[model samples]
Target: MNIAIGCDDAAVEFKNILKDYLVSLGYEYTDYSEAPKHSSNLYADVAERVARAVASNKHERGLIVCGTGIGVSIMANKVPGIRAALCHDVFSAVRARKSNGAQIITMGSRVIGPELAKTVLKSWLDADQIDESSLPKVQRIMELEDAIQLG
Candidate 1:
């Protein structure tokens, strides 16, 4: 899978760990990290870049990290056709992909430890491997997006 990954300064360490894990898993990915280590970078901007890549078909999936995950999730979801979920647990991570067909998963560095973050990432990736059964609901979501965007 071609995954697009990005992070703000607050989550740079966790992002590096995730990148290494992704490499270990042998998944080809694109790093959209916004800044050098310890440099302040806006989470919203990083989210926008990653989300745009997914929405544009430049990548198959996205993973963004920030202090709480909420800001990046919100910003990513603002883009049309981008389903970004802030998942902090295994169940939520699975549901984000299985139920919502979320193309992007966001994590919070301040809230979850590195080990748990890895677990969540694995859960999300595994969920994506499963057969998706929520096309009807996902279609409804797309329809809503169209309606909202058109208005």
Candidate 2:
């Protein structure tokens, strides 16, 4: 899947680390960022852009980061069709994808180290949808399919 990623100053290092992880896993991606960290950085702007990109289907998945992860997650979800989840553990990450079909995974720079972040991303990718009734968040995908006559 093609992923869109973004971060503010607080998570630049973490973003780059995760970007490398995505590359190693052979995922296509694009990034929106605040600064290079050698210079000034901003979180809000990057978050909005990343959210919009995903909302527009520029990428099917997104990863965003901020100091606490909450800021980016909250901002991304403000966009319709963008289910951005702030995940600190592997379970939440996986459940977010399976239940919500979340397009964005937001992480806190200070909350999770690179190794744990990698694990969570893998879990998110590997998880399967539980069942039709268990996936209210992704019910839209089913609704779309149900619209087809298949006749």
**lDDT value for model 2:** 0.82
TM-score, cand. 2 = 0.82
In model 1, how large is the Cα lDDT of residue 112?
A: 94
lDDT of 2 by residue, 1-151 (tens): 8789998878888999999999999997898885545644467667778889888988878889888999888888766666889998998998898777788889999999989999998788677455566676477655654565342
Worst 10 residues of 1 by lDDT: 128-137
Lowest lDDT sum, 10 consecutive residues, model 2, at 142-151
List of clashing residue pairs for candidate 2: none
For residues 25-130, could you state the per-residue lDDT of candidate 1 as single tens digits?
8888898876557655588889988999999999999999999999999999999999999999999999888889999999999999999999999899988643
Off by over 4 Å in 1: 35-40, 129-133
After aligning candidate 2 to the native by TM-score, how far in Å is the CA of 135 from where it should be?
3.4
- TM-score of structure candidate 1: 0.92
Which regions of candidate 2 deviate over 4 angstroms? 34-41, 128-130, 140-151
Each prediction's TM-score versus the true structure = 0.92, 0.82
